[model samples]
Target chain A: MTNKLLYLSQADVKSVGLTMAEIIEATEKGFMEMGNNRVEMPPKPGIHPGEGGDNFIHAMPAFIPAMDAAGVKWVSGYPGNQQKGLPYINGLLILNDPETGLPLSVMDCSWITAMRTAAASAVSAKYLARPESSTIGILACGVQGHTNLEAMNVLFPLKKVMAYDPSPENAEKLARFGKETLGLEVTIVSDPKDAVTGCDIVVTSGPILKVPHATIQAGWLNEGTFVSCVDFDSFFSREALKEAAKWTTDNLDQYNHYKDKVGFFVDCPGVYAELGELVTGKKKGRENATEKNFAANLGLAMEDMAVAPLIYKKAAEKNIGTWLTL
Target chain B: MTNKLLYLSQADVKSVGLTMAEIIEATEKGFMEMGNNRVEMPPKPGIHPGEGGDNFIHAMPAFIPAMDAAGVKWVSGYPGNQQKGLPYINGLLILNDPETGLPLSVMDCSWITAMRTAAASAVSAKYLARPESSTIGILACGVQGHTNLEAMNVLFPLKKVMAYDPSPENAEKLARFGKETLGLEVTIVSDPKDAVTGCDIVVTSGPILKVPHATIQAGWLNEGTFVSCVDFDSFFSREALKEAAKWTTDNLDQYNHYKDKVGFFVDCPGVYAELGELVTGKKKGRENATEKNFAANLGLAMEDMAVAPLIYKKAAEKNIGTWLTL
Candidate 1:
C-alpha cells in the first residue's frame, strides 16, 4: 500500500548536525563491511544528457545486507552550472527497506556527497598519515577543499594549511575561512607546487577530466607525507604515484573502471590494498612512520548508503523533514 | 533554488482518465522521435538485490530532446513478493526539466508501466496488424491481458474474444470481464491452442524467463494473424517466430542485451525492422493484409517519458496530487 514518505531538504540535512568524526566513523564502517563482503554495490550507471558529454547523471544503488538497508542515489554534475549561478553538482538519494523494497526516505545528496567524500579522504589520512601530521596542502580551494580540511582536521590536529587555486579571489576566500573559521594559519599560493611541497598531507580536490596541467612531482612530497587524490589523478605526477611505498584506492573495481579514461594507473605499481582491507585488518596501513603512502578514492556508493541511513535516523529523531504521502 | 514538485499518486493518475488511444498515440510519437534521432536513451541499469538474483531493481532514464522531457524511473520486480501478498512490481518515476536538471514531479510508475507496456503492444499492432482485425485471442490472462485488450479494443471493432490461462479460474474472470465490460462474446478455453486457432490477433502475455511449456505453432495462426509476444518467447514456439513473414522489436539494443541470456532470438531470422523504423516510415509494416507479422515489445523508457508528461499535465489541470517542496 502507498504510504507517507519522509523527505529531507538540504536545510534539514544540515540541521541534523552530523559531525565530521561521526561521518568518518560511519564511512569507515562501510569500508569494513565492504571488505567483509557484506555490501552489494553495482557499478553506477550514468546518463550523459548533454551532446558533449561534459555533464552526467549517475544512478548509484547499494544494499548493505548487514544493516538491512538499500538505496539509490541519483546525482548530477554539470560544470556549466557554475557559470549559470547554480551549484556544480546536485543530487537526491532514496533510502529503502531491503526486505520489502519500500522507500523510507528521500534526502538531498549534495551535502552527503560533500561530507562522505571528505570523510573518505579523512579515513585514508587516519590510517596512512603520520600521527604528528600538522601541516596540510590543498589544491583547488573549493567546497571539497574546505570539507576535506574539516574532515582531516579532526584526526591530524592540523595547524597550518597551504592552499592554491587558479583564481586568486577563491584562494583568498578559502584562506580566510581556514584562518578565521578554522583558526588555522593559511597561505594562498599561485603555483600548485607551493601547496604540496613539504606538507605533511597533500590533497588534490580540483576539477576532474583530462587536462594538461602542472603535476605534483615526487621531489615535492616528504618521506612521511600522505597524499589523497580525489580528482582522478589530475594533480599527482605518474612519478609521484609510482614512487609511493604504498598505493591504494577506495574500491578496485571502480579504480579499474576509470583507470583507462582518467589515463592513470594503467601499469603503475600494484595496489597495496583497498581502504576496506586496511579497515578490516586484511592489509596493513602504515608499517613505519616515514613510509610514503598514497590513496586514490573514486568515491563508492557503499559510503553513501552508510551515511544516508545516519541522516535518515537523525532526521527522524529530530522530526526535521517534510512528510508526503505517496 | 528549491521549488515545489508535483507528486501524483496511483489514484490521481487513474483519475486523469488518460484514454488508451492517447497513450498509444503518445507512445508512437516517442518511437517516431527516437527514429528521428531526437531521444537519448541509455540501456537500463539493474541491481539484483535478492539472493540468487530472483528480484531486480532497474534504473531507466531517457531524455527526449524533441519534447524537452527528461526523467528516470526506478522500478523493482520481486517475484517472491507475491508470496508476501505484495505486487510483483512497483516503481516510481521522476521527471525533470532538461534545461536546468531540476526535478519537476514525482509520480507512481505502476500505472504508467501497465499503460505504457500495453501501449507498446498496441503501437506495434497498429503498424503491423491488419486494419480490420475483429477476433482476438489472449494467453496468460492477467493485468497485461486486460490492458492489452483495452488498448487493442480502441484500434479494432472486436466481436469475439478467446482467452486461456494455466489457471482456469483466472481465464474465466477475464472472460466475465470481457462479456460484462466490453460486451464481447467471450470464450474461456482449457487449451492454449483452442484460443489462437482462428483469432485475428494473438497476444502471448505469459511469464518470462526460460520455461518448458506448450508452444504456439505456426499451424495455429491464420494467414493474416498478427502475434504480439510480451513474454519472451515462452508460449510461442521458436518455429513460430522463424516462420513469420516479418519480426520486429521495440528496441534493438535492449533486445540484443537480453538475447543471449534469455536463450532466445539467437539463430533466429534476421530482424526485419524495429518498431521505430515503421513509425518513422523508414520501413514498411505489413505489405499485404494476408502477411503474417510478429512483434516483441520489450518496453522502453521513451514510452514512459511520453506518458508521464501527459499525467503531469492532467494532474495540473485537475489540481490533483500532493505538491511537495524539495
Candidate 2:
C-alpha cells in the first residue's frame, strides 16, 4: 500500500504554525538520535555539473529510530531556477512505510529546506550561542536571511538585530519585517561591518561569492560571540572561528562530502565535533559560553525527517494538502 | 518553473501486444548509452533485512543524449512483495525537466520491471540462443516465469515449449498461455529433467530453493543450448553455464553489486561479459551457436531508464493517467 500524500502551499505550513522554538527542540532531538545511530541518513550523492554550476538532484532520506519515523526528501538545484523566478532548490519529502517499503505521503519540501536550514542554525545556537545573545548580524536578507532571523529570534533572547544587503530596499524590508513580525530592534546597515560589529551572534547565508568579498575582517569578528555560516566562505580563519567555545556541525560526512564537492572554505580545516557527535558524547560541547565557541552548517536529513511527521500529522489532522492513493 | 507530471498506470503500458519487445530494444540502446557515459546511473545500495534475504532500491535517471529525453526511475524490492499479494518489486519512473530538476511524470513500474527483466532474457536469447532452437524449458511458472515465456517466444523461432512447476495447475496454465496466446506446442512435465531434456534453450526463473531440490542437475545440462537464470541460486555452475556460446549479463556492476551483497553462486565462477559489453563489442556476442555459453542473472537500471520516456510518450500521446502541476 502507498501512503496518502499531502499537498502544502506556503500558506499550509504557516497555518500548521510550528514556532521556531519547537523546531529547535525537535531538531536537537533529531541530532541526538542520529548521534546514537538511531536515525537513518546517508549522503545523497547524485550528479553535479562540476565547476560550471550544473543541475543536480539529491534524495536525502532518514529514519529517526528514536521517533519511529522515516522520510525521503528529494531536492534539485540549478542556477536556472532563479532565471525562471523559482526558488533555486526544489524538492518533495515522501514519508514512507519502513517495513512495507511503501511511501506514506508526499509533501512540499521547499519550505522544509528553508525551515530546516534555519532550524539547524538554531540547533547550533542552542548549544553554541550565548543564552542572552541579544544582538545578531544578518547578512544577505533573502529567503535564508528571513528564515534565519525567525529561527534565531524564536530560540534565543535577541533584543537587537542588524542586516546588511547590497539592495537598500531588501534591507529596509528586512528591517520592517524584523520589527513588525519578530518585534526586535532592527537596523538596516550601510556596511557589513555595521551588521557584524558588537553582536553576540553573526549569521551568514548567501550565494557563492564570485570575487571573494571580505565582510568579516580577522580583527572585526566580535570576541566570544557565536558565528554560524550556512555558506562556507563566511569565515576566513581557524583563529577567527576557534574564538568561540565549540565547533559544531550538522553531520561530518555531509560537511566532508561538500568539502570534496565545493572545496575548502577559506582554509579553515576540520571541526571540533559534529553536533551529532556532541549529542552522543563522542566529543565534548562548549567548555564556556564566552569563547568563540559553537560553529556548524546545515546538511541534516533528520531535521527534515523530524519535521515531516509533524507536518504530516498536522496536515492530516487539519485535512490539508493533496491526497493520492496507490 | 514547474514541470508537468504525467501519471501512468499498469493499463497504460498495454499496446500493440508488443510493448515488451519494444522495451527490449530500448534497453539494448540504453546500455550502449550507459557505456558511452550518456546515462546518469549509479549503484543503488539498499536495505539488509538481516534475515534470510536482502532487498534493494535502485534509482536510475537517464538522459538519452541522441533523443534529448530525460527521466528517473526508482524501484525497491523486498523479498516478500509476492507473499503480500503484490509484486516482489515495486517502483515509479519519473520524467523531469532537464534544466530545472522538476519532475514531469510518475509511472507504475511493477509491470515495467517484469517487462524489462523478460526483455533482457529475450536480448540474451537473440545473441546466445541456438539459431535453429525449437524447444525451451520454462521453469517455475509464476509471474516471472510466465512473462519470461512471452519474451522468449517473441524473440526466438520456437516449435515447442515445456513447463515445470511444483504447482501442476500453474504449470498447466503456463503451458496453456504459451499455446493459446503465443501459439506454440506445450508440454507440462512431472519432473524438471523431463522439461530440460532435449531443449535447445533454457530459461530458469523462480525463487531459490529454501531446501535444495533437484530441478537442475549438473550432468543433464545440454551443450550448445543457451542457459539463462533469473534467480541467484540457479547460477550454480560457471562451467555448466559456460557450455554455451556466449556469457553475458544485463549489467556487470549491478550483478557484481548483488554478488558483493550475496556472494557468488557456489558453483559458477567464470560468469563473464554482460549483455551490454557484448552489444557494444567490448565483449563478444556469439562466436557460434554450438559453443557452450551462459548469461548470468543480472538486472540493469538502464532498462528502467529506457521505459520512463516510452511511458511518458505513450501517456501523452493517448492522454492516459493524471497530470499534476508543481
Candidate 3:
C-alpha cells in the first residue's frame, strides 16, 4: 500500500496563517461535540523522564466523530530548557484519516497548542462572559497571554487590556505586541491586583507549579466578571474561586487527574458544569447577567484534533508543506 | 533551532536488514530493564471510534531510563480493512531524544512490531524452553508465525516446523516460507490438533476475537513443551494454561487490563514471573527440564522503543531516508 504523508513545519503552519476566528469557531465546535457526547478522548498518558521527574511528555489522543478527525499529540514540558536556551514546550501532532486509519499530516504542535488553548478560553468566555464586555485583564505576558487576547477579539469588542507579568521586560514586550499586532490599547501593570481589578474578563495564564499561592484575590474581581484560569488555578486564589457564582472546567477527568497531581481543584468550590456542557446548551452557562463565572480550562485533545485537521486542510489546499511518501 | 527529523519508510526499514539476533538481544535487554524497574511504561491509551467499536487506535508511549530512549507508537487495527483491500494493522513510531524532548526519527512501525514481537517470544524460549528442542509447532501462518520461526531459529536448533491454518492455501504459503526463508522442513497439517501434538515448542499466534474459545487444547502437546500464546487466550484452552507448571505474562498491568476486557487472565493459573524477571535473573525461568512453562506476551511499547533507535542509527549511518526540518 502506498501512503504519502504531508509534513508541515512550524514555519509552514505559520505561512498557512490560520485565523484566530477560524480556530475559535472550530474549538467551540469541538467543545460542543464533547458536550454532546460525540467525541472520545482518553485521559492523556504521561511519562516523566530525566532528573527529578520534573520533565514530562504526555500522549494526548482523541477521536471526534462529527469532525471525522482522529490523532495524537506528543507534547513535552521541560522547565530546565530555559537554562539551555531552548523552548520550554515543544511537540508534534499526527493527524490520521478516521476512515482509513492513515496518518494524513504531521505538524509541529507548538502553534496548535498555543492557538487551541487560547481558543478554549475564548469559547468559554463567549458563553460565560457578560455581553458588551470591553476591558480585559491578563496575568503572565507569555504565549498564552498574547494568544488569549487575540482569541478574545473574535467574539468581544475589547478596546483595552491591562497586562501584568512578574518580569517587567516581558510585560513591555507583550504591551508592544498587543499595540502592533492586535492594535489595542495596552497598559502594563506592576501588580497582579492592578492587572485584575475591575475588568470585564480576567485570564490567568501563568506557568503551572507545585506550590499554590493566592495571586488573584476575591476582592480584585468586579461584579459580572468572567474568569478563565488556563494555568490550572496557579494564579487564582481559593477565595477567588469560592467567590464565583458558578465554576467549571473543560473536562472532568483531566481536572481530577491534575487535581490529584497538584492540589487545585480539590480545594476550590465544586464545579457546576463543564464548559462543553454549557457550549452545547446541555447545562446553563450564565444564570443571570450579574452572575460571576469562573472556568478552568486545562485544554483537551478534542480541541487539537479539531484544529489540526483544519490546518492540514488549509496547508494542503495552499500547497504549503513538504510531502513525503511512507 | 534546526530540528531536522529523519523519516524511515517501511521499505527503508526493511532495507536496514536488522538481524533477528540483535533484535532479540535488545528486546531481552528491554525486558530486563522492565524487570529491574528502570523503565516507565504507562498503560496504553486507546480510542475506539465508529459503530460496534470493532476498530481501535492505541497510543503506546514508553521511556527506558537504561536505554535513554523515549518514543510513542501510534498503531491501529481495523478488522474491516480487509474488505477494502488494506492491511489490518498499520502504524508509525516516533523516536524522541529523551534529554531534549525533540523527535529524532519517524519510522514505520510494521517492521518493528513484527520483529520485536517475534524477538520477545524468542527471548522467552531462550529461558523457558528445553535446550535440546528439535521440532516446533506454530498456530496460524501469518506474519507472527513466520517471524516467530525465524526468531526461534536464533536460539534453538529446530529441525522442522508443524504449521496449521484454517485455509489450506495459507497453510501452504506458510510451509513454503518456512522452507524457502528458514531452510526448515515444514509440514502443513489439516487440524490444529495434528499441528501442535508432541512438539518441543508451541506458539499460538492467531487473530484475537471478542469471544474466548478453546483452539489449542491440553492433550495436544509434549510433556515439557514450551507454549507461548502471543494472541491472548484465543487459541489456548484454559485447560492447557492450567496444565502448565508455571504461567507468566510480559506485563502484569496490561494482562489485567485485558482480563477486565476479555476475561482471560482471571481464570488462568497464577503468574510465576514476568519475562523481564527471568531475563534479569530476579526470578527463575525453568526449574527443571521436565517442568512445563507458558508465556503470554501482550506486546509492550518498550520493545518498540528498544528496536526503533537501532534502526534509526542504522538508517542515519546509511543515509537511507528523507529528512525534514521542523
lDDT of each: 0.83, 0.69, 0.87
**Candidate 1 — number of clashing residue pairs?**
0
| Tens-place lDDT digits, model 1, residues B1-326 | 34667878778888888998999988999999988888888878766676877777777888887777788888888888888887788767888766656677878788899989999898899889998999999998998998888888888888889999989888988898888988889998888888888898988998885652547875788888888888856776767666788888988888887786656665555778899999999999999978888888788888999899888888988999877766
> TM-score for model 2?
0.91
Per-candidate TM equals 0.93, 0.91, 0.97
Ranked candidates (lDDT, high to low): 3, 1, 2
lDDT of 3 by residue, A221-272 (tens): 8889998888777887777777889888899887887788656665877788
Question: Clashing residue pairs, candidate 3?
Answer: none
**Residue by residue across B77-194, what tens digits does model 3's lDDT show?**
8888889887788878888888878888888898899999999999999889998887898889888988898999889998889999887887788898889988899998888887
Clashes of each: 0, 23, 0
DockQ of 1: 0.42
DockQ of each: 0.42, 0.36, 0.76
Chain B TM-score, candidates in order: 0.96, 0.88, 0.97
What order do you get sorting by TM-score, best first?
3, 1, 2
lDDT of 2 at A11: 58
The model with the greatest lDDT is 3
Using DockQ as the measure, the top candidate is 3
Predicted candidate 1 versus true structure: per-residue lDDT over A12-78, tens digit per residue: 8999999989999989889989999888887787666766877777788888877666888888887
